[model samples]
Target: MFSSLFKRDDTFYTLLEASAAEARNCAILLKDVMTHMGADTSSQLDAIHQSRRKHKRLTQEVTERLCKTFITPLDREDIEHLSSALHKIPKTVEKIAERLALCPVQYANDIVSRQINLLDLGTVEVVNMVGALRKKAGMEHIQDMQDRLQHIEGDGDKMLMDLLRQLYNGKADPIEVLILKDLYELLERAIDRCRDAGNVVFQVVLKYS
Candidate 1:
């Protein structure tokens, strides 16, 4: 019975790892989209769309497997909630990518790049937290990560508001202002989703620990 339980635990961890990989890929795709601001966005959007689809499929598989298995590594509800939150990461990224494709703007300003970098860092930290989920007692690091994510997200919000105000007040072309507004909003949304991911991880750690 002990051996059987260990096998079940390994299977659950494997599923969680797969989900984390998908989330990481989504983050990378978002970074690529920001890096190639003026380049052809068609390919980047396609890549993000594909990643989102794959994440959805993997999430479904994990859920179905959890339902069928007699033993689970964590509480059944925790498994369900974790899987749902993991699925949202990619979906949220895809939404931003789609909006970006619609509003094509070449950002000469560095604010976009900085915001994307912060978002990527937050995603990386959250991914690390997800990996440590199996060890409930090792979740002390999650609180630190959550705090960092919140801080970065707050910074992003402030930067976005400042830039928006400058754009509205400055002598930039109206069309340019519109494009930057949309882009800034999308970038802020991405950062917000990363915070949401952190919150979900925090809940998981709290419930289990």
Candidate 2:
């Protein structure tokens, strides 16, 4: 009976994966929003918000499970930290979506699209990293994945700087410049959130390995 009762709740990994998937969904939706900036993208924005909320619920479940369970697949703190990191990705993506909805159509240029693509790639990688936790992959493998996220985040930082440099060239409209700057920073942040989640997973592997 005790074996059945204490069957090692692995559902925490599942919930974390679901949260990571939601983060990826937000990135995908953000891409769609970028492509259709001139069109009414309220629906896409709504979808991103919904994904963030879903991730929030997953985070809550993780916390609740931590409260009820004595044993876990990972350190309790690692699980909580990872859950928080994953939740932030979608939350940040939702902010990006909101900003994109309000951004001027003319500013939805190729650079913005490239940045969003980078964001999407980062979130996808984050999902992979979280899922690998359940598989108990080797530290080297998880570190490789984490290193990719670091590179993606570095690229995002460079892209943001490039965008800012262009915006500050003194020829652009001041108001639009301000709006674009805010959006670009938010994109950078979302990518960083993915990197942060990767770092958490890599640390967890290091602990167990």
lDDT of 2: 0.88
Query: lDDT by residue for model 2 over 54-150, one digit each (tens)?
Result: 7788889899888888778888899989988888888888888888898889888888888899998998889899999999888888888888889
TM-score versus the correct structure, for each prediction: 0.83, 0.95
Clash pairs (backbone) in predicted model 1:
none
Q: Candidate 1: where are CA atoms >4 Å away?
A: 1-9, 170-172
| Model 1 quality (TM-score) | 0.83
Stretches off by above 4 angstroms in model 2 are 1-6
Identify the leading candidate in terms of TM-score: 2
Q: Write the per-residue lDDT of candidate 1 for residues 1-209, one digit (tens) a residue.
A: 55654455557766776787788788889878876666788888889888888888888888887757777877777778778777777877787676656655554467767877877776787677777776664566878877888998999999999989889896988888987788788778877877876787788788777
**C-alpha lDDT of all candidate models, in order:** 0.77, 0.88
